[model samples]
Target: MRKINYKDITNQQLIDVRTQHDYQAGHLKNSLNLNPGNFKTYATYYLDLNQPVIFIVGSEEEGHLEELSESANELGFNQKNGYLLIDEVPKEDLQTTETILAEDFLNKSDDFILLDVRHPDEITRPAPEKNLVNIPFEDLVNDYQSLDTSKQIFTLCGSGNRSTAAASFLESKGLNPKVIEGGMKAIQEIGK
Candidate 1:
């Protein structure tokens, strides 16, 4: 399988396959909004089969980006089209990250910014505690800009997948962000 990273998507066009709520909240710079399931139609209409196209979404579990690419390839979209850029957190660290966030940061909300990487709708529907910001994984690139580089930034999401990836991204940017051991769900249950 070919490997691609978010950093490799500088010049290519981006297709954000997230909800309208997630799209409006924030997304990668210059990403065209579209739902992942409906992307095939859009690909045929607007996206030239000759040019590259990068696809993004809020979460892999929510929308199978990998499967989307496979479908695209099967449909001959990749014959001369652009590559798809998908960001996913490794499964190995998911459990460890969840434990840390719940054990360390949630109770200490005052001491850190609880950066929730889940979609805005997921966090906002139940409404996170006052200090949380729903940046989502797809929007992490944009939301990270306004943050204070010097302060401690904690990353968390639904299961811990997105948050780990997000934490790595911030670390690369020199923010030195901390990943919440588990994620929001873990924090809610274990935290007071």
Candidate 2:
């Protein structure tokens, strides 16, 4: 993998390696916002190993592109199309979205569709029943179309990280799903 200009790029998946706040502020349209910390374990679930991919890296991750691409290769995704410096992307090409707090979500969850974005193996605790859907964050890329567009969707994962990724992807698809702040851990702490 090597550094490449965004203008010369085409037809490759864009993976954004920015913090959730920076990502929600602005990102390449249709790109998936994945946390770099969980890139190997969680990223694989959302990616197709056969497809060529390019990462749009944040300032903090800029120095680690080679390492990231190496990780991608070791994970069996060898078709890396290189990476882009987030600073180089045109402002017009970026988009933004919103997030919701866990506390706020609890108050009005019944009125919204609750999307449990955690992988099945991660579910060790009970979640609220009303309107809850357990579509793992990885599957949402393909299954988002099946969701009802009329109701608001609240995204949840173990912590707030993966849910933000899910919420950002949903936002790109034109739905306004709020990432439940701090995810299940926050809910559990609040319950306790």
Candidate 3:
């Protein structure tokens, strides 16, 4: 497999195979954080097999890079596109997306499009607002064009993982989407 230097990656989709806590601490802008446990499944759901994907692993754990590379190969990701060692990239080159907390989102519900990225069956509970648009993350790659690009989209999932992926996908498509930090679980807690 090829190894990529951080500065050379211009248009390739970046997938960070790191623990969620590490990812949330800091990650490349628009990079999708695929937790090791869900890497295979998330790759299947969000990745376009034809597009080039660059995997980013923490410099402290170079050992995990090979394992992540193997997992990507098994999931049909072309290994020739290569991996990136996160520490090699300058701190200024990395950035995090904006995330709205559940309570904060609820307060501004009228100003944003509430996008529920959960599966249809998983949405047994009704949304707090009537502006909810149900488009599961699995269908986003194909159905994103149907959404109104004019409005700001706030994405939510069962917890928060799927929404992060959804927001990254939306951003790639040039749509502004903010991930709801705590997702439905936070909303439920607020209701209680």
Candidate 4:
């Protein structure tokens, strides 16, 4: 197994092994779909070795970076370079929707913007009571200007996958956005 460093993966190409329900709920930018259950066939026929690949899943429930790293090695991907991560993990206390809702989101509709980071297909359908702005996870970086970076923002998706990535990117740019932990599912339950 070839050893690679995590810092080298600046292109952000990811391989998802979680369920389809998890993927459609939200995913990383430029990610290629691969179910871990069928990874051998998928990797044998579909994986592109030239591009740097990071293995990901919905959450640690899917196994942390250790599991992903091991799988990537078995699939003949660069073990040294591959990353293992839950699509949504809390970063500093502000990375989860639950944390935001408990302290900030419930009280600050006037001061913050609610951004939905799911695909257009999900956002255009019936949604929860929370006022939300639609910007798919994959498009967030490209269409970032469409969002007002100066304000405090709250981002969510169907399952919190895309929202986490969206929140992190926005934060890296100096915008303090809160991630809705479970994404739309949590929002819907809260509204009900």
Clashes per prediction? 11, 0, 0, 6
Model 4: residues >4 Å from true position, as ranges?
5-99, 102-104, 124-131
The local distance difference test score of each candidate is: 0.56, 0.81, 0.77, 0.56
Model 3, span 61-155: residue lDDT tens: 56767677788778787536678888888988776656888888878835567899888887866666657898887788789898888888888
Error of 4 at 98 (Å): 9.7
- Per-candidate RMSD vs. true structure? 9.8, 2.5, 2.6, 8.2
lDDT of 1 by residue, 34-127 (tens): 5655466444543455556666655542346666677567656654333333335233312211225366564564555667777767763242
lDDT (Cα) of model 3: 0.77
Task: Output the TM-score of candidate 2.
Answer: 0.84
Off by over 4 Å in 3: 1-3, 19-26, 50-52, 59-63
Worst 10 residues of 1 by lDDT: 89-98
For TM-score, the strongest prediction is 2
TM-score of each: 0.48, 0.84, 0.83, 0.52
User: Which of 2 and 4 is ahead in TM-score?
Assistant: 2
Which pairs of residues have clashing backbones in candidate 4? 3-80, 4-80, 4-81, 65-84, 97-180, 97-181
Ranking by TM-score: 2, 3, 4, 1
- Runs in model 2 deviating more than 4 A are 42-45
Per-residue error (Å), model 2, residue 97: 2.4
Better of 1 and 4 by lDDT: 4
Whole-model lDDT, candidate 1? 0.56
In what order do the candidates fall by lDDT, top score first?
A: 2, 3, 4, 1
Best by lDDT: 2
Clashing residue pairs found in predicted model 3: none
